[model samples]
Target: MAKRAFDQASQNQPTDEARDAYLEASRAGQSQPPETEAPAAPEVEGQETSEALQKQPTEAEDDQQKLQLEPEKDQTEQQQKLQEETDKEHPEAEGETAAPEEPETEPVDFSILKNGTVNKGGNVVNEDGKAVGRVTEGILKHLIGKKVDEKGNIWSTDGKIVGKAEPVSESERDELLKEPAPFESFPDAVVDKDGFVVSNGEQVGKVIQGDLAILRGKSVDPDGDILDKAGNVVGKAVRWEPEPEPEPEPEVPVDKSILAGKRVNKAGNVVDGSGVIFGRVVEGDVKRMVGRMCDKNGNILSESGDILGKAELVPEGEREGLKEGPFAELEGCTVAKDGTVVTPAGDIVGRVIKGDAKILFGRAVDEDGDILDKNGNVLGKAERWEPEAVERKKNPMSGRKVNREGNVVDEDGNIIGKLTSGDLQKCSGKEIDDDGDVVDYKGNVVGHCSLIEDIPKVEEESPEDKEKREQAEQDKKLAIQMSVCIEQCLDKIRPICKMITEKIDKAERTPEDERDEEALVREVKPLIEEGGRILSEAKGIIKGLDPDGRIAANAKHKSAAREATPEEHHLADVLKDLTGDVTQCIDNAKRKLEDMPHAKKELNPLWGLLNEPLFQILAAVGLLLAGVLNLVGRLLAGLGLGGLVDGLLGTLGISRVLEGLGLGSFTKSLKGGKKKGGGLLGGVLGG
Candidate 1:
């Protein structure tokens, strides 16, 4: 006795083996059912004995099966008519009928037959319902002991012809499958569960809707070669191949002498080496961008504006003035003594107006306050303190001029007073000669100056003048060092950047345990802090030159960096590459660290499903395979092959397999997964 395990579905449906066994008796040349049937002997230990293994069909499947029968009834009638007409001319169809009409009657119960047979009206199926000849007495006599030939012709084993072959096409397969797609080539084609095609009483080749390649009674597979009943190769199909990927471009080398950097504002725009906006984040979950970002034409950014990157566009029109102008260069320059502004280029452009950041434009001016151009032509009016007033403040002895007679006179030559010995002693211009006598501007002896005649002959300085002179020297040194200060700041950021880059690269290659994320942050933090300190110092040094911070620079950087010296402008780009790169690198390191735990957590459940070492290895391999399939699925989508691939996946049940592997979403995502809020979730999944 054969024992069998029956599941819920199996309990409702008989297996194809049971049905095929019933067909076996008919194929065994049984003419009629025996009077007393013997019980079937089941000796095979592992062999299936029940027909319940065959999946039960729903009402829709039932309709499809009925559909196969409906077409054949009409086809059989047409063929019988054709045979009847042929019989009128040929002896070969002599026995075929253009039979007279008979009274309508109920179906004949072939009580002699044991099990049963699949029938369409009066016709019967020989190839498991993909019939080649009818079961009617007339046709049975002709088909008895016959087999389907290589050409699908029903012929006696002794070589007598019985029936014609049918050609299996797409329509035949569509009829076989329950949920068939719309294709209208065949008008009356039919197929059984065994991949056999039958139209009327003629047998046909196998058909498959999914694989598009038939293996006799085997299931469809598109990538497989077409094989006959004996597994002989009969035909081939051209497999789909995705487009070849383009080779990656090489990276450009940078000059070692200059440290490069960028600044990404809160808006996710990238500033490059020249304060020009290089690119902007246009897409993704960048909802936190501080402001709307635009390009040269004022077009909005379209890329997913990551917090750090370089902008790719240079703006047009007056915007150019923002980037390359004399005033722009003066940004980050140094202030000199004598009220002159010393740019980093080592040129004096103008004087800083007292008590304000205003520049004098260096126009020539008269003592009485008249502005003049280089040609000495009056260009404009200027305001200044009168010479006399300035002189009065400079000296307390502001009154009289002395004549040759040593008499002091006022305006109009009126004699106001006579020069006294004390007045002569107080005279600034009067100096005691080597002979110790007081002399006037004309070397005339003004008086025999009393004691303390040795006035030390040393020029004394005012506190204010001394301070101004010292400030001038400091300014001169600073003007020369502006570039150096900025370069130093960027240099500090560079090593940190390199370390972060190296860390990210290493993380990609090694497992999480092997990653030195802590070391990366440790190395990068101080460098960033130090970079920040250097930037602040550099900005302070250049503040006077860039009062508004468009140029000479600051820690609060933007994309407007420029240099006073045209040749050294690249150096003055203080906020150019450094700021964005430093922050971006730091963020990248942090992101990698953050992502690791989540990735492991998401994958851990899958790992938990496996315990044995072999199973673990298999799980790993499965993940790898899933990764590969996901990649291939993406490539296929890129090539515009969505429908074919999706259909194939469904057919081969690879889609279900992927779902079982926890990559279900990945495989099905191609159809409708475009906009996923395009934000945090998008970034997370993409990463």
Candidate 2:
């Protein structure tokens, strides 16, 4: 404020007249380095600038002019007005004419802000009224077409107003000079060249396999974020959805028997040892594939691009130029001249040295009768396996047999079942399965065994013979039903008979003094009643089966007409006599009991013999059965009914002889029954 600047600039010191020329130099478009001066006072910083001096009055003018503050003056204008007043008021009071000197400085921390100054206006103004505009945040970035100082402190408007100047920041200028910037000015996005897969701009996982990606080593939904097993979000999923489930691979049919054959020649043709081509590798290499069905290494393309099977893994050591790549794992295996795929172990897995071979289910197994997998687990047994048909001269029932068609055949030439591998079971003493097969002890189906019905030599019959056969079948069924019902009735009858026999024994064991007629009557009545009912039912059933009394309906009353038609006629005659025997026994006991009321000292002795009626009834039944069987033997001469009857009777475990009756010695009784006096009643009751 003391040393006032004039309305002219400092001259080169040629003369006082040079002042106007210096002022003219400051106005012209020229750049000059600022004069290095001591640090300015807190105020009046604008008065020290050369531009201010160039606009100020000279000292002579300053001595005469008076200065006053003007309202609405900015910092710069205020400094100018105050400096003029100070110099005119106190011309030589301060360092106004001090000698030029070098200024000292230190590297002090630089701050764009002044102490206690609020930076609300987004600028730092020095005392000299110069604004420091840097792009600290958002200030002065859009000052287009203007130049900024190299230090980014000052803006140049090229003579324009400071506030209205369109000055540009260095960064903005640098951006303009660069190639057209990417569409994003700031570009908040970033990328990491690695395959951190993204979906909808969110990271999901990283690629591991060629087609697979994972998050935290686990699968994630590609359409969303990767969730941990607990459902916490680990990351977002990448947008790689599995390729649209490629249309399901088409199923291609390939003949599997081709695998049993020889390796193909280099020309892809299967040749014999003489090099004659028997077959050509139409699709896959014969060295890799036995046929279209082989899955050994290499494409099995039919040139038609139909994939028959997947390329199988060849052995590690033999993969190099091995022609029989398919047999790498199977040592000692060879394609026989007969097209048998023989293993090194002297076993054949399939047949035929070339083309398709049919390895029989029969005779293709180890001695243990077990079919083992490669891992040695028991898959099954090829029990009693047989050889080819030409070799099958031995009895089949002696063992289980397998056929070429993979069926298990029993010794009787019947197909009992099938097996994927050879049959491995014995055929002795096994029960027939529902499938008409004799299963091994392990329950695996062996070959088919002959059924009971199949054991008969059933020949094609004439129409009349067919009718008889049908009748025989019907009779057999009806007989079975009748026999079962009779047994059930017998089961009921036997208990009653047993009870009566026990009562009789008790009566005989008791002393005559201790015997009671009332108690005996009560006990024997129920048994006699129930036993009578059972006998009646059994007789009714026998009659239903043989209504004509064992004689044919067409038989006349005389001559050969008296010939018995079936043994069932004998059965009915015997049942009638048995009924009479029971009735007479009951009548005799009742008569003896009536006499007990009068002769009180003697209880009826009839109760002691109550068991005789049961024995008589049973003997009569035996006689009936024996005569019927003998008559049947004569009636069905060549019809093969004897064997069937035997089988059905076997179910009851009954034998050729009746239990109480000696049927073999009944010859006299049978001959005598023709005469009325010597009937079944007399013979069975031993009269």
Best by TM-score: 2
- Tell me model 2's lDDT, rounded to 2 decimals: 0.40
lDDT on C-alpha atoms for all candidate structures:
0.38, 0.40
Report the C-alpha lDDT of model 1 over 240-359, residue by residue, as the tens digit.
223569888786642321112333445455454464555445444445433444434323333474332223333444223334333443343444445455555656554444432233
Off by over 4 Å in 1: 1-481, 513-524, 544-568, 571-591, 597-687
**For all the candidates, what are their Cα RMSDs to the real structure?**
45.3, 24.1
Error of 2 at 109 (Å): 85
Best by lDDT: 2
Residue 58 CA displacement from its true place in model 2, Å: 99
lDDT at 461, model 2: 78
TM-score of each: 0.16, 0.24
lDDT of 1: 0.38
